[model samples]
Target: MQAQSLSYYEILHLPPPPHTTPTISEIRKAYHSALLEHHPDKSILTANDSSTPTVDEIVEAYNILSTSSLKVLYDQQLESVQQSKKIEEARFKRLIAQADSIDLDDFQTATSCVQHSKDIFAESSSITLSTGYARESCHGYPEDTCNLQQIWFRNCRCGKDDAYLVTESMLEHAFLESDNAQSDDRQILVQCSRCSTWIRVLFSLAE
Candidate 1:
């Protein structure tokens, strides 16, 4: 039988022991009861040519759990499965939390929604890139359109004037929609050649 079909504990309708294994007496009791209840010859349904989890099937589960080495292996497999499930759940929750107040079920606006999972470690503490970096493409504008060069800086904020906006010199991934996406939106700076608007996408969480 497939390992997934029934956890040894589930076959006997028993809970996992506190220490990750059942006692020998407990295993014996459950196995005996299960065999008595589901014995093919004695069970009415099976006597009438019906099929169900035979007593042997129960025994198969019992043997695995009752044996010391097999139980250890089964416990490891179970732990791995449980761990994987937890990680997946955590990842989904993280994605949902970053959804920019947008509904995850909304597949229509999913493409437009930009969710930022702010990592303090990833954030730059200070401006490392030198100012006046030229950019050919703005995030919102078409490709090769943002011709504004010479990104300047201020006290705490950056530039967003009519002609050109000074990038923070640390603003990375101003256009990336998702962290799992194909392209890396982490770049120095971007500005629109038409509107002279600088593309700085800082999520509320990152702020």
Candidate 2:
């Protein structure tokens, strides 16, 4: 099961603090509402042994928000979390701008291709271009489907080290623009044979 990401306020369906502070009574009300819906005894999810958070979680969230010391600490933590998100968003925008400046067709020369990938992908590792046939492996990036890593590299700058650059998406965009992708989202993943880091490669002219 996917990990939980919802904040305490979000789990309770109340406005985050500093915007609208939920009173102790409101917190209690929200807790009961969510508890009845997600409580283990009433929840069908318990039958399947699912990973959904339990009623204990609802009580915990309510206690944190309803208490003075705990609520202040949680609010501070939320502020830190929001600030991190904003930083990530700004970094993403910069990477998008960088990816836009790259020339995908630089594959004409090995050095040019290496330079392009480095500039656009922004990884410090050196490039080791793949010369052999495609390796038989997959990264399973898009949910369940295993996308074959197209370009096989022996010693190269491995996959994306920075979270800001959406290398997989950029590679797909570049690949579709450079070659015929046949309307398949499955073809978007690429990988490093040496480091085993997931990367993206273009489709071949042969198929």
**lDDT tens digits by residue: candidate 2, 1-207:** 121767888778899968988888999899998888787678776534444556666677888888989999989999998999999899756654433222223232221122234332233243223321112111222323433333322223544322112233345565556554565322333333344343333333333
Alpha carbon deviation, residue 9, candidate 1 (Å):
0.9
**For model 1, what is the alpha-carbon lDDT of residue 199?**
37
Worst ten in a row by lDDT for model 1:
108-117
Best by TM-score: 2
User: Model 1, 41-153: lDDT tens per residue?
Assistant: 67776544333456667888888888999988888888888889999899766654443321112211111111111121134333122311213112344434433322332
Q: Once all C-alphas are superposed, what RMSD does model 1 give against the true structure?
A: 17.4
* Structure candidate 1, residue pairs in collision: 173-185, 173-186
In candidate 1, which residue ranges exceed 4 Å CA deviation? 2-4, 17-20, 45-52, 99-207
Model 2: worst 10 consecutive residues (lDDT sum): 131-140
